[model samples]
Target: MQFIDFKKEHFSHNKEAGHYFIQISKDEVGYGDLEVLEKQDDDTYSKARYELVDDVSKVTIKMKNPGNIRVSF
Candidate 1:
């Protein structure tokens, strides 16, 4: 839910800016395996393995039947 909220607030801005990365993980802390979602020049989404830096925030995630996965700013 926190991630959804973050998306509602920030995703649009990032989309408009045209250069942003969305860090995806199996936990809020993002310490384990992770992925990065990015918008390409064709305005499509792409994902890849990535390791986030220390600045990302952690919050409880609530979603329907998820694998405890989360997306963060």
Candidate 2:
């Protein structure tokens, strides 16, 4: 799973660093969507969408089934 960590400094940082916005305005950023990968019986993954929770300082993803799940943004 790959995560964009907003916990770091903006604009200049590593891959996990946040600042994912392409353009920034005074009070808004860009619109983005997330992709989820669900683990299958063969240990492979399949594209799936469940629920994504975005808080002020934290982000969460909920899956229908409780198992190994990976998300990309």
Candidate 3:
């Protein structure tokens, strides 16, 4: 599922002119590959899979069937 919230200031609109926030979350128990993409000038995307960091944070805990994770962008 996808959720998009935005505000527009004109009758004729441009998507780039709005301020918005997006939230994407899986609604079921799942494990999948996550890919990061870079947008190109001609409206195409380049996919990139980054290496997962092992020790970015000092805090560590064990989670079983975890339902929530926080990511800051």
Candidate 4:
């Protein structure tokens, strides 16, 4: 039995410029992992960077399936 199941996990950040999103695997959500969803070259870049920080806050875990986990920062 599993507690969660998802076909894909997504991460995103919203800024004055636009919204950036990325699909991440469960294995990548760990300490010292540098996950880059998008990069912008403008004044909004800093804001976007800030928004991206701590994006994985709500994470769901599932049994049996290695990829059936969700992480929100």
- What candidate 3 gets wrong by more than 4 Å, as runs, is 1-23, 28-30, 48-73
Q: lDDT of all the models against the reference?
A: 0.36, 0.44, 0.28, 0.31
Clashing pairs in 3: none
TM-score for predicted model 2 compared with the true structure: 0.47
Q: What is the TM-score of each candidate against the true structure?
A: 0.26, 0.47, 0.27, 0.22
Model 2, global lDDT: 0.44
Ranking according to lDDT, highest score first: 2, 1, 4, 3
Tens digits of per-residue lDDT for model 4, 1-73:
1122233243334355354444434454543333222223431211113122334542222222122222333
Error of 4 at 55 (Å): 5.8
Clashes of each: 0, 0, 0, 7
Model 1 earns a TM-score of 0.26
Residue 9 of model 3, lDDT score:
19
Cα RMSD to the true fold for all candidates? 10.6, 11.5, 14.6, 13.4
61: Cα error in model 4, Å = 20
- Alpha-carbon lDDT of model 3: 0.28
Clashing pairs in 1: none
Query: Order of all candidates by TM-score, from best down to worst?
Result: 2, 3, 1, 4
lDDT (10s digit) by residue, model 3, range 1-73:
2222212211122256342222233332123333334334575545422222223322221222221232222
Question: Compared with the true structure, what per-residue lDDT tens digits does model 2 show for residues 1-73?
Answer: 3433221123222245331221123123223655656667897778755555565544455443344555455
Which portions of model 2 show Cα errors greater than 4 Å?
1-32
| Model 1 lDDT tens row, 1-73 | 1332234223212345343344334354444433334444575545533334444454233222212223433
